[model samples]
Every structure is written in structure tokens, then in C-alpha cells.
Target chain A: MIGFETLLRWLDLAGIAVFAASGALVASRKQLDLVGFMLIAAVTGFGGGTVRDLLMGRTPVFWLRDPALLAVASAVGVLVFFTAHRIENRFRALLWADAVGLALYAVLGAEIALVGGVAPWAAVLLGVATATFGGVLRDVVCNEIPLLLRKEVYALAALAGAAAFVLLRMHGIWRDTALLAGMALCLAIRAAAIARGWSLPAYAARRD
Target chain B: MIGFETLLRWLDLAGIAVFAASGALVASRKQLDLVGFMLIAAVTGFGGGTVRDLLMGRTPVFWLRDPALLAVASAVGVLVFFTAHRIENRFRALLWADAVGLALYAVLGAEIALVGGVAPWAAVLLGVATATFGGVLRDVVCNEIPLLLRKEVYALAALAGAAAFVLLRMHGIWRDTALLAGMALCLAIRAAAIARGWSLPAYAARRD
Candidate 1:
């Protein structure tokens, strides 16, 4: 049986791989070379967690401390570079994988912040940031409008998950149960958004 | 008489203001709202230093410790919001001001990294990252290509300044002298790039 911490680490790595594949697919769409694919992939995989750690004063960053994460990201990059052309609907593939990564990272981020002794509200904010910032960075670097700023319910979904995790832990729920529930909530929201075109309304100025 | 640290702080504030202004101008061009202007400005003003501090394990981040910096950035955002349309050439104005901020930040970043006891090479890298990353963040968030990744002398100019600063300090040069010389070299290169169109060659794959 895996220790709780070990299980969490595996989830984190799975999230990283899916996010990295999405990044590499974006690089392929942009006609970038292998190095570009790897660079974008690695950043996408680690970028959110890196930002979360930095804001929370965690030094050396998670990836710098653990080389295996980078190796996985780079391997995914290479694999995607060679095979992305074969995919019929790369964008759809990216969105679904991204949704999974988003859900996992949101719960993980909130849990980490909770463990770090941040306030529950701040933890939830960090969770949402952690879940979405990598994709934001990926889109930004690729010169696309970030999905976060889009009308899509991406960040709202992350926020719901993070907030749910925080609230559950506050209510003395089991940690594992809270984590699973948080991810499920996030994934369900995101999956529905993708399938049904659910989105938050765009900002509208009040007319006098 | 002002202390050296005080002088550096003033320079840092000045750099923040210029960068913030550039960010606000971009926001104006993008037709973002007031909140968007302020958010972009604040991030642009502090993003580079924030990243540098995070990488170096500097806790709380520089801006979080100094609310004055945030206030200044916000003020600049508001100012630019009202006045940007009056400017004849906002792009040219941004370039010049950005060049100044880039030069100052390159030296300051290198100095701080050295003081923090990082290796010279790492310090140089941090310096360049610090000098240009705010603009990169600004461009990225604005949905444009970052100047750093372009076929230009931007990061190269920062690299020269940071390298010169480190080399000068290694030879026991006076801190003031080294700082000024580094800034001068960086500004000169950046100015020439803007005025004379100096640029690095774009990457080209070899033909078989």
C-alpha cells in the first residue's frame, strides 16, 4: 500500500505529464522545433506549482528539487513532437487532458497550502492559481489569449474544487476523501463546460 | 547623505514606475478596463523582481514587503490610462522607458544576486531574467510575443550588463562604478537596438 504522501506525489506526476502533453501539442501547432516543444512542455508541467511554491516561499521549487518531473515532461515533449501530427483533433485532446490536470492540481495545491499553514481562503486561492497558471503560461508564451481570461468556466471550476477541499478539511473531513471529492467536483465541472459549452458571461459595462 | 541601499531603492522605484507605465500603455492599447490596467501595471512593475526573489529564496517577495511600490505602480497605471491616447507614439515611448528600466534592473539584479552569494554565472542569468522578465510577463499577458524571445538584442544587452557587473566586481572595482558602468553598457546596447535596429539573426534550419 502506498503512503498518503506517495500517492499524492503520483497524482502530481500524472498531472504534470498530462499538462506537458498539452503544451507539446500546442508547440506542434505553432510549428516549433523539438527544443521549443520540450521547453514549453517542461514549463507547462511545472509552471503552476513553481508559482505556488514561490508565492508561499518554498525554495528551490519542486521541479528543481526533483529531476524526475522534468525528465517526464521532456520525454512527453519529444513523444508529442513526433506524434502530434497523427492526432485528428489535437485541441480536443489538449482540453480534456488539461481538465484532468486542472482538477488534480487544484486539490493538491489547496492541500499543500493547508499543510503550509496558510489560511483556508488563501489556500483556495493558491489552489486555483496552481491549477490554472501553467496553462496560462503556456498560452501566454505561445502568444494566445489565456483560457483563464476567456469566458470559459476554467478558473471557476478550479476555484470550486479548491474551495470545496478547504471547506471539507475545515469540517474535519478525512484528507483523502476531501482530496478525491475536490478533484471529482472540479473534473465534473470542467468536463461539463467542455462538452456543453458552459461558460461564465463576459464582463459587460453598465449603461447609464 | 543617502546610503547606497537607499540610492538603490530609489532606482528600483524609478524602474518600477517606468515599467508600470509601459504596462499601462499596453493595457490602453488593448482597451482593457481600469482594473485591468492596474493589474497589468502592478504585475509588470514587480514581476521580474518577484521571480528573482523567488528563485533566490527571498521570502515575502520584494513588492509584498513594500506597499509603496504597489502604490506607485497603481498610480502610474491610472496616469497612463488618462494620458496614453495623447501620446504621439506610445510604442516608441515604451521602448525608451523600457530600455532604461531594463538597464537599471539588470545591474540591480546582479548586485542583489551577488550580495545573496549566488555564483557569478547564476547571478548573470538572474540579472538578465530580472531585467527583461517583467516585460515578458507584460507581453505574455497582453497576448503578444515577448521581446526576450524575439530576434533582438534585448536579453543580449542585459547579459552584457550583468556579465560586466560581475566581472568588474571580481576585479575589486568600486560598487558605484560597477553599477553605473553596467547600466551604461546595457542602455547603450538597448538604445542602439531601438535606434539602429540591431538584432540577432533569427533561427533558420539548414537546408539539405
Candidate 2:
């Protein structure tokens, strides 16, 4: 039987790969060269977890502890940058990849936060932050409005998923089962939002 | 003699206040209201130290542990936001305030890193991060280029200060004396750079 830790680690790596690919696509869109692509990919892949770990006081960040992940992210960036010309609709591609990463990250993040002794509510926030902040950092670096600041369904999905996991744990559910349920919810909501072009409400500035 | 820890804490709070003031000025320029002013000010003042602490595995975060510093930063934000119109040459004012924050943070940050058992080089990087990351986050949120990314003498001053502090400490100098020397060097370099408009070299994209 695979240990829970091993299983979660694998899923986390998958999340990182998908996020890195999406970041590379963004770099291509911005017309940045090799350096930009690698930088963005690394930031997106490790950024959310880095922020989460820092906040949780987990020393020697994941990437810094295991630099192989960074090398993997860099490889993905190079791959995407070189093959971007063959891809049609980079934004669409990024969204699809990002959705997968979000689902995986939502579960992994909440689990880590809970294990680290954070309260449920803050864990949910950390889960959402862990799922979204990488893309946010990528956007900021590329000089675009961060998706977190936009009225998007992205952060909402992560929040709902994280909450679901925490709620299940509160009800004595097994950790692995709860995580799987959370991932499903995240993926479902994100997929629906993408398909239906869903968005959260925005507050317009008053002219009066 | 005041305990070294107490003196350092006081200096750190002073740094936060000055950085917060600069952040409020930037918020005013961006036409952000009260919430934005406070948010920016808090981030600009504490962001660097928070990141440094997080990286060093100093959990609960400095501001989160002791909300008093945040209160102080918010107070500065409130004061600046209310009196922004009355201030002449806000940018000039921000520059000076930021310079003071930079010097103080340079000393405090390196000291914390050394105390935290981090390697000397990493501690220096942490010091530079502590001195500059707040401003970097402020620029990102405000949709401006980060000061660190530009060819500025700012980060360089912090780096130099941090290195000097570490070097002096390694040579068996008194901690308080080393910190003072480091702060002075950071202030003098930053002031000169500001007065002469000195900058590092920019890597412009080649126009082939």
C-alpha cells in the first residue's frame, strides 16, 4: 500500500508540472525569451507552495529543498516556448492546464495546512492561496492584472473545494477520501466555469 | 545598556513606519481609498520582513505575532492618506522615507538571518529581500515596475550593508557596532544615489 505521503507528493508534482506549462504559455504570449519563460515557469510551479510554506513557517521551501522540481519546471518551460508556435489558442490551453493544477493543488494545499496545525478557515484560505497565487505572481511579473484581483470563479472554486475537504475531515472522514472528494469538486466547478464563462460579481466605481 | 533584542525590535518598528508612509503615498497616487491605503502600507512596510521570516521558518509571522507593528503601519497609512494633498513633492518625500527604511531594514534583516542560523550568503540575500521586497510587492500591486527589477542602486545598497554586517560580525566585532556600521553604509550609499540619480546598468533588449 502506498503511504499517504507518497501519493500526495506525486499529485503535488503533477500540479507543479501543469502550472509550469501554463506559465510558459503566458511567457510566450508576452513575447519573452528563454530567460523569461524559465523564470515564469519556476515561479508559477513553486510560488503558491512557497507562499504557503512561508506563512506556515515551514522552513527550506519545497523547491529549495528539492531543486529537481525546479529543473523539471525549467524543462517544461523550454518545451512550451519551443513548441508554442504549433499550439493554437494559447489562452485556452493555459486555462485547461491551470484548471487541472488548481484541482490538485486545492487538495494538497489544504492537507498540508491542516497537518501544519492551521485552523480550518485559514486552511481553506491557504488552499485557495496555494492554488491561485502562482498564477497571480506570473501575471504580476508579466505586467498584467492578477487573476486573483479579477472577478473570476477561479479562487472561488479552490475555496469551495478546500472547505469541502475540511468539512469532511470534521465529520471524521479519512484524509485520502476527503482529498479525492475535494479534487473532484474543484475540477467540476472549474470546468463548468470555463465552459459557461462564469464569473463572480464586480464592484464598479461610483461616479457620484 | 538596552538589550540588543529590544533595540533591534524598536529599529525594526521604525523601519516599518517609514516604509508604510511611502506605501500610503503610492496608494494616493493610484487613487486608492482607505482600504487600499492601509493594505498597501501594511504590505510595503511588512512584506519584506514577512518574506524573510517565512523563509527562515519563523512561523506566526512577525506582524501576525505582534499586531502592534501592523497598527503602527496602519497609523502611518491613515496619516498619509488624510494629509496627502497637504504634502509637497510626495515622490520626494517617499524617496527619503524609503531610504531610511532601507537602511534600518538592511541592518535588522541581516541580524535576524544570522540569529536564525542561516548561511552567511543566504542571510545577506534575506537582508536584501527584507529591505526591498516590500517595495517590490507595492509596485506589483500598484501596477508599476518593481524598483528591484530596474537598474537602481537601491537593492545594491542593501546588499552591501548586509554583507558588511556579516563580515564585521565574522571578524568578532560587537553586534551593536556592526549593525550601526551597516546601517550607516546603507544610508550613505542610498542618499548619494538619490542625490546623484545613480543607477545600475540596464539590460536593454537588443534592436537587431
Q: Write down the TM-score of every candidate.
A: 0.60, 0.61
User: Which residue runs of candidate 2 sit more than 4 Å off their true CA positions?
Assistant: A1-45, A51-57, A63-135, A145-208, B3-10, B88-90
Which 10-residue span in candidate 1 chain A carries the lowest summed lDDT? A199-208
Each candidate's DockQ: 0.15, 0.14
Candidate 1 chain B least-lDDT 10 residues: B81-90
Q: Write the per-residue lDDT of candidate 2 for residues B1-208, one digit (tens) a residue.
A: 4687787778778889889888888899899999899999999999999888877787777888888898999998899888988764657866877788899898788888889887777678689879988987898889885656553478778888999999999899998899999989999999999999987443222322
Considering just chain B, what TM-score does every model have?
0.93, 0.93
lDDT of candidate 1 over B1-208, digit per residue (tens): 2687798888888999999988887777676665556667987998898889888988656764566887899899878766766642557877898899999999999998999999999999999989888988888798888857984699899999999999999999998999999999999999999999988789899998
Model 1: DockQ score: 0.15
Interface RMSD of each: 5.9, 6.1
Docking class of predicted structure 1 = incorrect
The alpha-carbon RMSD values of the candidates against the true structure, listed in the order shown, are 7.0, 6.8
Clashing pairs in 2: none
List TM-score (chain A only) for every prediction.
0.93, 0.92
Q: What is the lDDT of residue B85 in candidate 2?
A: 84
Task: State fnat for each of the candidate structures.
Answer: 0.25, 0.22
Could you give candidate 2's per-residue lDDT for residues A63-154 as a string of tens digits?
Answer: 64565686689898888767766553456866877798898888788888998999988899889889999988888877888867884788
**TM-score (C-alpha) between model 1 and the true structure:** 0.60
